[model samples]
Target: MDLFTESGILLLPRDTFLTDTHVQLLQKQRIWEVEVQQVLSEGTTENITNQLMDLDADKETVAAYVKALDKTRSLFDGIGRDDKPGLEQFSDVFYEVAEQSMKQLGLFRSLYVLEGSDSYTYRHSLNVGILCSLIARLLKWGEERIAFMGLAGFLHDLGKMRISKEVLLKPGRLTEEEFDQMKQHTVYGYEMIKQMEGGSELLALCALHHHERLDGSGYPHQLKGDEVPVECQVLAIADMFDAICSDRVYKDRTSPFEAAQLLWKEACNGKLNIEFVSHFVRYIALLYVGARAVLNSGEEVEVILIHQDEPMRPLVRRSGEFVDLRHERTLNIEKMIG
Candidate 1:
């Protein structure tokens, strides 16, 4: 059977039989019921109760996010297609968006819970930009630097426009040659941004090197350690986190808490900046305290405490007992119900 959220958004479309994984995906996203009909309507639902939470985003924030995504999609499609898109027009909307969001509390909350998961390219670009701005604010960067990071993130993937739609949107794994070709998006982005009227070298560099790793394991250049610019390193973390946490064609979306754990692991492995990842992980844990979540064993839990040393493994309360995830290494906050 097919399933959809109350918003009438497609969840699992008309499957002959739902597998365990499919059921798990729905549960993980906290989706409960779906409508079925011989002729599915573009019509609306009555008094639908959204299963998502206030922590995800307030109405205004969600509306703004939707507008930003639409704008990003428009700009991405228009830019370089005949010079109809002005570089500053993109930043005019983008930088203002990042700056305006600075006034909100839980600035990262909306970033953690965007809908329309299939709109990865458009949504991911905007989310990475929003994440970059949030990180800059957390780091106490100057306004100019914060805006610059947002702009860098907003246009980071513009080079993907040069790729063929088939290879870019393939539902399966790409062959090695195709993968190599895919990596060229970084260079393509760098070159594209460099020639744009209003972009700077720093912006272009962020596009080029956001994929580079701290331990020299990244693509485009094997630049290691201090060689990688801090901007690029920060962007790299943001990009990777969004990619992991957000739904993609081949995978279901992982919860923000689980995504934090993966980020922490990479930091420990030296693939990411420890300072950035550690701070982000701690903040994420603290932000999700009192959140409702589902453990992998299909048990519901409430996060009660964030362990300073192991932020990824927060203590949770379930069935009147407090369970320390740090001790129960196998148990995880698989999905945040909010």
Candidate 2:
């Protein structure tokens, strides 16, 4: 049975899936069958819920998580308008949803591949949770610390909610005044999280220091690398990965391969952590294998994992020449395709 109905609501085995016709009827205010509340209140199928709890990384189940994220994004976008849906309430929903998604993603190699540009703010937060959890697992961090870092990723961008939509969605460079106001989002997000119930100072610091650079050049507070919390550093790297790969209204998206290259270059320049970049790149490269993508020449190809030293530039099979992307001077991954 399909997990989602035509109206894009979850449907358990006990409930029937709605067709597009049914949604049209509802839109026309027919209201006879499947009221809005009944549709939304439908719980996930028992099987799916079990898979989610067990952190299964099966393809179908992971797709369900992606669908759930899309649904939550719609719900979140409706918050804080004239209707005044409490921003805190909306943030809570994302936190809970992300916690669940992260657990499932953690069972896999890396959450970086699931990262995309379509839904930036919501998806970026979720990706951060996944990456942070993976890093925590790799470091053998205690359970409590892992949970705290996961929560920190969720709250990393809470400050953005306070920024005006005009500024947030602007397609070009910001004025000095607008840029200054945007910088305050970090502080705003930290204070907002601190005021919430069950809020941790550690998590708030993630929101605060996520933008800080190792060279003490970042905003709000120019904390040097040694001064920043280790947890914040992890989140900072994850945040940068997601931001560069995602297509913002103001900036074009970069491929994960290119982003990784730039991150490594930054580390070499002492602006980021070299060890962390190495580990993050290792995990991210695992996720790209067998994934279809475009080459610099705009040809479609499939990645073939090889050579641990150069994971980002994998051997690819395009036409027939097993092109070692790392060695090919002219070929590089342009973008990930279906």
Best by lDDT: 1
Question: What 10-residue stretch in candidate 1 is worst by lDDT?
Answer: 40-49
Model 1 segments more than 4 A misplaced: 1-56, 105-107, 110-116
Candidate 1 positional error at 187, Å = 0.8
lDDT digits (tens) for residues 1-338 of candidate 1: 55667688777777333435776888887977545444211111111113123445665555565567656765775553545465788887686556556665454554555443445677778778988877776788898888888888888988887776666777789989888889999999998888888878889989899989889999899889988889998898889888887766667778788898888888889989988887777876788888778899899999899988888888999989999988998898777665
Per-residue lDDT, model 2, residue 25, is 54
lDDT of each: 0.75, 0.67
Q: What are the runs in model 2 whose C-alpha is more than 4 Å off?
A: 1-118
Model 2: per-residue lDDT, tens digit, 1-338? 43445677754333344545656755665344543333222122333334334443555545655655554454444432213344355455555555565555443323333332345666667667766766776677998787667667766886776788677666689999999989888997788667766666777888888888888878788999799888877887788887777666666667778788888888788878788888888777777777777887989998787569887788889887688887896888877653
TM-score of each: 0.80, 0.74
The weakest ten consecutive residues by lDDT in model 2 span 36-45
**What value does the lDDT take at residue 261 in candidate 2?**
80
